[model samples]
Target: MTATDNSTVRDADALRADMVRALHDQDAITSEPVAAAFAVVPRHRFAPEAPLDLAYDLHSTVPVKKDENGLNLSVMSAAHLQAVMLEQADIKPGMKVLEIGSGGYNAALIQELVGNDGVVTTVDIDRDVVDRARRCLDDAGYGQVKTVLADAEAGVPDDAPYDRIIVTAAAWDIPPSWIKELTGNGRLVVPLTVRGTTRSIAFDRDGEGLISRSYRLARFVPMQGEGAAKERKALLRDGVVVQTDDERVPLNTKALNQALDTPRREFWSGAAYDLPDELELYLTLHLSSAARLHASKEIVDSGFVETSALLGVPALVSEDSIAYRTRRENEDTGGFESGVVAHGPQAEALADEYLKLLRRWAENHRCRGAATIRFLPGPAPSTLPENSVLKRHGIVAVSWH
Candidate 1:
């Protein structure tokens, strides 16, 4: 090989080593097998067009394809996120694995974990993504990894049962096909979005339903095809918006905007504010009429809504009112105290209901992995459990334990 090629090879090796160490330090790589896979795989080879630094960046994603509106269709997920999900899967050598979203790099990592005796299949709805993944996998010396063009809703059943099914996209629901395709003791690691919030949950089969082993904060491009999320969004104004997946929640944009014009009311919970992600899950699940409130930085800077709305905080809404989470510096509450901000005619009621949840979450489920999520397939039971969110295929219920 030429000296230029030799230099590029050396650079990649050094970068890969750095990435492995960083993943370990970041606690993304916990297992020796996962570390070995990260070390051996040529991550840059999967994103050849990308700069070496970007390909090796611990927390940055390399864009692959984009829609006409400049929105991402697919991206090579961040190394840190991938490592975290893989560790959740905990695949063993000679195990059958299937990756729902086709990204050559992740599939290649799965291939390394499964080894030569195992098989890896990656399926994607976009033909371009599938073809690109196929080419990249071949170039990265993972030719055995199969790439297929199809919607992920109906999994690659030809492979029968996969010991581990890892979904890279943000799935709205756990389709029956996915559970049917998993082995008896199989685990599926998916970025499951509910109530407009996404979490990468590692679930294992329990009877006909699936139960969560652990969940971590995650963000990904929404899944496409039949399993695509039925997103409900209302633009309150140029810079403010409300989004929800639950059809039960009303998004009266005009009334809500009018309510914003009313004076804002503040309600303090007098509870400690820690572990925001966990608190978000509890609030979203327990809130009777839950939606997500979002505000652009420009609008936030204009002093319209609190900073919590900037990150799309859980909101409780009525026909003419809205209330969302907020925080304050409180030495008594041990640094920060959770609170609620409300607007419109029913502000007091909305704020009261929301405040109750904020205090409940802070008092009880304030720690990590405090929720047990169960995906029960088929039609909902006549008597649904508390904190259950209805889905097309099944019911996703969460309980704080």
Candidate 2:
């Protein structure tokens, strides 16, 4: 059957159950409230145009809105990642919640979890998204929730003292105003970029100080409108494509595009793992740091293919890994190194560290277990590294200036 035809048969309840199962598999649906919220919200309604195969995928991203350039501007987010955010927030009923990016799907889910006693106010910079979200909510019988088409950076101050605030986009830094608007004991969950890695973190305001509990590696479309981020420089290397725009950071698919043509056999044929894969892996890990250290990747073709061949590339890290494609031109040898391009030392370092961490994390945890990665703002330590463990509850702490 066609995608829309399939959507007709699979109702929201069934889809929600499947989503719950997916979250459970990822260890994200730990709370009964979060599970019920996922069960009650109809995700398909929010992303009607998604492919049929993706309708039931637990960790797939469903595009909700795309920009003029065909870039996804907003999305429903991956099911597992959403669950991770909820779990991290420790959402409860009767809590006033502020959602920076609003749509019927996410607001409805939050409203269901917060229950009738609680209040949910969603804000979006784009009036179109706001109006569309309103229509969707009304259609879904969620008229009680409030939606505003204004800058999220200023925040919904009139309704200040929110018990919980969730920002569903990648933010360069948490606005001080958001913290001030939060309740004395409020929780502000945001996807924060540290160095170059984006991880969702739930920061709780305790008295005058703020503390974070959970962290999960995540990738989200950049937050736009009022507090939009400044553009970042693109990394340029031989045999790769780079694209940039005025508002957002430059696209960094040079390495990914290069991976498509590079034969996997270049790295894997002689060794147990693929060389191109290893190089790619190194790039991913180091990119996080490179984004922090040097806003760009500068690779000099060092012909270190043999060194890369020795180290087996670690398996993919997260669900988003599926979104990437590594292809080959000829069938004779695995096209591990044809399409892929190595940007710079940072990319290579990221790939190398990713391999090491994958092995270490797997050995220690056995299962990823819906683990969260969080970055917390902390004062640089006198003796320890800037991000040293200021406080550790159940998540890792990476300090951001």
Candidate 3:
């Protein structure tokens, strides 16, 4: 090989080693098989358009395809997240795996985990993504992995009864086909969006339904096509918005905007605030009229909304009022204390309800992984279970213990 070719190879190898070490240090790579896979995969080959540094970045995603509006339609998911999900899947050699989203690198990594005896098929809704993934896989010497061009909402039944089904995109619900196509003891690791937040939940078949083994906070491009999210969004102003999928949550945009004009009310919960993911799950599920409150940095900087809204926070909404969580540093509480910010005539009542839930969570479920999530795949029950969110395919029931 020429000197320039040798240098490029060395650089890629060095970056791969660094990436594996960082993933291991962060506890994302817990098993030897996963670490080895990360060590060997030439991640940069999958996203040839991206720089080598970006391809190896532990926490950054490499964009592959974009839509007409410049929104990402497909991306090579971040390495740390890939490692975390792989650990969650716990793939064994000779297992048949079907990945719901097409990204060549992740599917290649799965091929490494499953070894030569296993089958790896990746499906995507976008034809461009499937074509790109196929080219990248062939270029990266992973041509053994099958690529399918179709919406993964129904999953790839051509290879049924997969031992593991890993979804790379954010899913709104667990469709019936996914469960039926899985082996009796199969595992489905999906980034499931509940309320407005997404969690990478590792679920195992429990009778006809599925139950979570663990869940981690996750962010991903929303799934497109048949399984797209049905959430409604109201742009209250240039920098603020409210979104919800719950039919009962009143989306009175005019009244909600008027509430923002009224004086804001603050209520302190006197409860220690930490473990944001766990706290958020509790708030979103328990709030009667739950919605997500989001604000741009400009609005937050102008003092119209708390920084919490910058990344979307659980909100209790009424026809003409809203209350959401905020935080402040408190030495007595060990770090921060949770509080509620309210607006409109029912601010006091909304704040009271929000504060009660916050305190209850802090007192009873302050730690991580305290909630158990179950996906009951069937018609909605006449009386929905407490702390449950309804979906087109089924109901997501979550309980904190």
Clashes of each: 0, 34, 0
Best by lDDT: 3
| Colliding residue pairs in candidate 3 | none
Worst 10 residues of 2 by lDDT: 316-325
- Candidate 1 lDDT, 147-186, residue by residue in tens: 9899989888999699999999999999999999999999
Better of 1 and 2 by TM-score: 1
lDDT of 3 at 22: 90
Worst 10 residues of 3 by lDDT: 327-336
User: What Cα-based lDDT does every candidate model obtain?
Assistant: 0.92, 0.59, 0.93
Q: Where does the lowest 10-residue lDDT sum fall in candidate 1?
A: 360-369
lDDT of 3 by residue, 4-79 (tens): 8799889999999999999989999999999999999899899889988998999999988888999998899999
Ranking by lDDT: 3, 1, 2
- The TM-score ranking, best first, is 3, 1, 2
**TM-scores for every candidate against the unseen true structure:** 0.98, 0.64, 0.98
Give the runs in model 3 whose Cα sits over 4 Å from its true position.
none
